[model samples]
Target: MSNCSGESNMSDVLKLAQKFNCFYLSGFRTSECKPFIVQGFQVGLIRPDVIKQLLSFPEVFHFNQDCVELNPAFRDYDTRSVKVDEVLKELKTKNVFMTLKGWRDECYEVKTQFDTPSLLKMDRSATCLFGIRNYGVTINGFVRHPEQGQCLWFQKRSASKQTWPGKWDSMVSGGLSVGHGIFETVYKEAMEEASVPDNLLKNLKSAGCVSFYFESERGLFPNTEFVFDLELPIDFIPVCSDAEVECFEILPITECLRKILSQDYKTTNAPVVLDFLVRHGVVTPENEPDYIKIIELLHVPLQTIYWHRNKIKENGFGANEIQGSQ
Candidate 1:
């Protein structure tokens, strides 16, 4: 076994585990010399070979015979290995695991078994679960004018936030608090982020809903977003909330699509809304490469039903009528 200088941090251990793509079993006591498998060798017993392997990998700080005890940070990881045939099957089904880069440096913690349910409420920490996390509702709407065609609206996200800070995004997008419904969340975000009134939002059309699982260099954010559409009068001016929106623009949809496709736009959330719009035929696919890439990555369907569409149709009403009924 490699002799530990008796001084190593959890970060060092995590780097080793990630490099080897190995499982880090935690919650083990140091008292027992449990014989466990380490690098295919039966170690922690009388066997010196296993100890040698463990020592060679300096990242492994604690070990026992039954299992190697790692830092708790890697406890809830998705590190299942697949055979070549299984990999092929996954690729065929479009269920391939895309590698997430840059998480090694981020601060992470193992969700204690007891804290799993409550911790899952937070957007950043929730993705560790096998289930999905409710980040927020994403509203996609249009500001129209008689002469200028439809102008797209986007909001600049707060710079103080952890993910996608200081970037432009959908007009009104935010996380749902613990007790709020999807509609209530969207309504609240629209009013807070754009100064849009609830009465005006009553006319917001339910375009569709999309569930996305994305893990990039930043972090994993699995979102079930409800897309809404609204048509405003040409002269309708949106007052920007400095906290949520840096400024408001009235660019034509064509210009918006161009900037987005070229990656010239600083908005991270715009591509998602644009992808939904393109799938619904609101925006042409020919000029939406960024949106197309997003659809491909998430494997979202070309078109889907708005979560509230059935109820609206059942009541024999449009968006305005449904709002009135509510």
Candidate 2:
């Protein structure tokens, strides 16, 4: 709860939703009310009669004009029985999985056993329709100097990457897949992306989670990133073992901040680095006019999407895999 001191020049940084072409909906954008009435609200796009065909399975969604609302009852049924995954797979086969803009196939998961259940399993590819929440890991690898201050290590994603190709990103990042634990995924991504050894991995600090919801050409991306802070040796250099990264660079904290402000880093990477700068005193509350807003942007409320993780049964899948930093 401490405040940062710098007045940030990145005041024009895009809002989470606007960065991805999305808007919150309590009601229609126009003055007229929507045709069908529903209790709760949803995050989605104004597509054609797409929901009409999907409504055949009454338990999945309720359609109103061009808007589609996820049925709350789908959560009661088991994963396979609800057939949400099966339906999406079929849709993909028929080329119904159209992208309004460009495309990316970054994969993600949908847990139907949670609150609202319309689509069972959605990946990075199909999130546009329903705005499903996705989880991942991001590590801030840095080195401290007694006199010169802190330096951050950044990676340039490969030009071939499905999402954010050729953009500067956090030192390490990867999706939190269905069967992996936080620590396990961290270890895997660090080794695969940056070749970080287990010796250094043992020193990783869990800095908690950052959540944000955005809409992109692919779809609505509701993301929660489990952020880790790792203090690496000053001379340690990172080598990319996987084709996911194009190269690596170590920049002074100021350079990193400049890149973020200039929009040189990937869209999501800005918030992660901004949080770091604020926490480390690089950007203080006094200097940054939007300090409070930046702080709030990192922790969006995800109670409904995250509830099932707490209700896991003894025999539940990946139950043993869920835990804190190793």
* Tens-place lDDT digits, model 1, residues 1-326: 87563324323212222221111112111222233222232211212322443443334324544344332332323321112123223332442222222122221222222123322122223222211233457776677656777677766666664556666677778665555667887877777777787667877877666554433333223344567776665665667565656666667776665545433344335445555556656554464333343354333321121212334435666544543232
**lDDT score, candidate 2, position 127:** 56
lDDT for 80 (candidate 2)? 31
Distance from true location, Cα of 254 in model 1, Å:
1.0
How far off is residue 301 in model 2, in Å? Answer: 2.2
- TM-scores of all predicted structures: 0.50, 0.72
Candidate 2 accuracy as lDDT: 0.63
Alpha-carbon shift of residue 261 in model 1 (angstroms): 3.2
lDDT of 2 by residue, 49-119 (tens): 44545666566566654345556555533553335555666666666556522234334445532234433
Q: Which ten residues in a row have the lowest lDDT in candidate 2?
A: 30-39
Model 2 CA deviation exceeding 4 Å by range: 1-10, 13-82, 96-107, 112-119, 304-326
